[model samples]
Target chain A: MSILVIAEHDNKELNPATLKTLTAAQAMGDDIHVLVAGEGCAAVADQVAKAAGVAKVLCADHAAYGHQLAENISALVVSLAKDYSHVVAPATTTGKNFMPRVAVLLDVAQVSDIISVESADTFRRPIYAGNAIATVKSDESIKVITVRATAFDAVAAEGGSASVDALDAVFESDKVRYVAEQVAASERPDLSSARVVISGGRGMQNGENFALLEKVADKLGAAIGASRAAVDAGFVPNDMQVGQTGKIVAPELYIAVGISGAIQHLAGMKDSKVIVAINKDEEAPIFQVADYGLVADLFDALPELENALS
Target chain B: MKILVAVKRVIDYNVKVRVKADQSDVDLSNVKMALNPFCEIAVEEAVRLKEKGTAEEVVVVSIGPKACQEQIRTALALGADRGIHIETDTMPDSLAVAKLLHKVVDEEQPQLVILGKQAIDSDNNQTGQMLSALTDMPQGTFASEVQVDGDKVNVTREVDGGLQTIELTLPAIVTTDLRLNEPRYASLPNIMKAKRKPLDVKTPESLGVELGSKVSVLKVEAPAERSAGVKVADIAELVDKLKNEAKVL
Candidate 1:
């Protein structure tokens, strides 16, 4: 049986998470193909072609596929469903948004936010804000899944050449249309792709205080993140939020600042390889899971920490 | 306009969940159950719309065990006019939940359906979108703001980048985010009044739908524990330790 992966990327560059999904797909026995569906997305197709273990690249280029609308993408995926036994995508906003639609269209169930592949049908995923892990097995003939990119290694892009093929599937545009898009321009790495992340919580107090985190993050070449409390307190944008309601991230190093480790917040970043908590509250719950704990006023320690990094 | 709100019963957010020793599932023995936080927001949003005289009726639906009727009653106390509980012992897959809700939507004939972005229990943010696709209804997910006009709804959604505003016609699905609104607690008087409110309980089998299992649980396990680090005495020592010992900097 063959596996099909949906490649995520901007038109100019492929997201590294695509390779992680490829690694998961490789575990299903390596007869894999990647689908790069977008308008004028040949560059993404080309990038997918160079990824290891990719047997072929199916490019669906059309004006209707520009926005990667769930409706159209679901239709395309359903059309491709018959050819593959398994389908995988990185559990990003885009993947999560569309994979369920495809699942419904194909009359199958989707395993969302899978952390590990137990078998062809069974998988491991977090439940109750990462407080519990559930291993699920699907009995359906076609397995649709969204893989957590952080749990798997990204496949190397060397020693393989993938043949590119143009999909002839017709687009079925629906009510959803492409709207104006806005992207945050940050010097730090993207939060989902970052191996290291330093997040500030309400402990930082104000937006300007986040500069302390920026300094430490810059020194480590890490992404800057925030707790929902910090975002709700207007200390940072919602995009920086790392929690159950926000983005679930798993970086190599996760440093939580001034943030009381709420269960919801821990549910998101607790999967990080190394956790460091710098909160003055000695009884803060974050310390329970933190590898490194410091009971200090973040305001006082932040400047000193920044200077030390310099 | 008729509005539909989907609710879920989950362990109270404040309660610390414990995994069973066998790694099969979480221990729910004496844990207090409450309506999901996001679902509370969704119900509150619907209630506000009805309070403004914009919505003709607010119908709350939940798909879970028979005990979920308590969550529906909770929603009734919060101001929903009626409740529909698709009783089942096991939690169905997201697609199955959406299908069951679609069946309810077809019967209720509501113009709008609002749901929590994801249930706190499964953390699978799929039901709302799946329902939208199943019913071919337009969806506005992770909505922070929702405004209903004559036949269209303007929704401000929370995206990774920032807030995104979208407009969709009637018969749409909207999922709530955390900052949508502060949910009000049910007063004692309201709780008494909710007892008199009508709550209809029906089995999925009675609805002529076979709740099929999609995914099966193999095991449950606690995440790996992190080793505790040393607590330094001062900033100078902390910095020196971080630089020379920890080597993170």
Candidate 2:
């Protein structure tokens, strides 16, 4: 049976995460269709039509799905679930919010944040904050999955000319209303998709100290992130937190500053291609994961690194 | 308004879980288990709502072995009014868990259902949303802040890019995020008080729910390890290697 991928996008622009999810879809089978559900998101549908390996794009444009909220989006996906054997999305917050409802309505189990697709029915996923990997098999007829973007290489966006189809569905979320979105206003690339990530932990001491990392990040065109402890200590906003409970990122270069990495913190960024840990403690767990570990006070190393990079 | 919170018993967040030699599952034979961290946040939120008069009553529930009552009691000690234990030895799939919770929701008729977004163990992150689907309630997942009015609940969610706020009509579901609140410890007096709180044990059968596993564990193994590497002498050496060798700079 064919697969349907729920495209992850905010009305204006398509998120790169959709490409990563499509990469996983390509591995599963060739008959892949992407469903772009949003209000006035024809642009997103157009982008999906260009994603490599997809057969078609399903654009479900309606006022009811203005924000891709769970209530209506789940209904739209459920309506389209009949034609496909598998429905998948990038394991972002948007996917996590709605996929379970689709699984439940379809009488199937949702295999979430799958790192690899062993077979059509079998999958590998990390459990307990990446300490152990569990290979799970679904017995349900229709498989619902959320793909961890970092596990798969993103497919080229300009390589295919898949046809776009408009799917109309009567869907509305009666019980939930959009309030307000407070996005962290930043010019830097998104942490999850960035090529470089310069992260600071609690030892950065305060919010002002993050400026040091920001300087280095600016030189490298990298995104700024924080450990859970740094976020908890109010050294940065919660959105910047990188850990098991926060965003999982696998940038090409991950520079961990003053972060004595807890296993929870390691779970998020350990998959980076090259890791550099800068901490005063030689015994920091962050060092263990780092390809290059620097043992010195962050106050001393921060400036020198910033100067060297600049 | 009444708030119903679901707590799950999982391997304590601090424990270093080890995979078994046979590759079946993690060795939980004698590992210390506790209430899931997110569930604790859920319980803490429910208790805070009760304390602030936003919720008139707080009820805590768990679906697991009888030992899960210990987690429920912990929730009660933190401040739930009562506990409901859906006692079972094996964990039913998320759908089954939602079905069982559906029965309790029908009986209790609470205005709000607060649950952990996912347990650290198994981490399917589906039960609350599934319950919302089966029960026909709007859900706010990964919620960091929840503010309740007469019939409206505004939840500030921790989304991918930043925070998104959504207002859910009453009788909605909210799954807790880590930053919602720091859960308070159960003091000795409160722990003793929780022992006297009403604790009702029920079964999935009693709720007329068919609990079955739709997913099977094929195998389990340790994740690929990243061994410790060499320590650089200074910032100069680090930059030299990053540019000349690894070339990520």
lDDT of 2 at B153: 93
Residue A26 lDDT, candidate 1, scale 0-100: 84
* Candidate 2 chain A minimal-lDDT segment of 10 residues: A165-174
Q: Backbone collision count in every prediction?
A: 4, 0
Q: What does candidate 1's lDDT look like per residue over B1-249, in tens digits?
A: 899999999999889889999887899889999999999999999999999999989999998988889999999999898888888998887888988998998999899999998888888889988998899988888888888888888887776656667677788899998888988989999989988988888888877778877677888888766556666666677666655766655
Docking tier of model 2: it is high
Instruction: State the lDDT of candidate 2 residue by residue for B1-249, as single tens digits.
Output: 889999899999889999999998899998899999999999999999999988899999999998888899899899999999999888777888888999999999999999999999988899999999999988999999999988999999999889999999989999999989999888999999999999999988889988778798988999999998888999999999999999887
Candidate 2 stretches greater than 4 Å from native: none
Tens-digit lDDT track of model 2 for A16-67: 9889998888777779999999999999899888888989998989888888
Q: Write down the lDDT of every candidate, Cα atoms only.
A: 0.85, 0.91
The regions of model 1 sitting more than 4 angstroms off are B234-248
Query: What is the Cα-based lDDT of residue B206 in candidate 1?
Result: 77
Find the candidate with the highest DockQ and give its number: 2
Supply the TM-score of chain A against the true chain A for every candidate structure: 0.97, 0.98
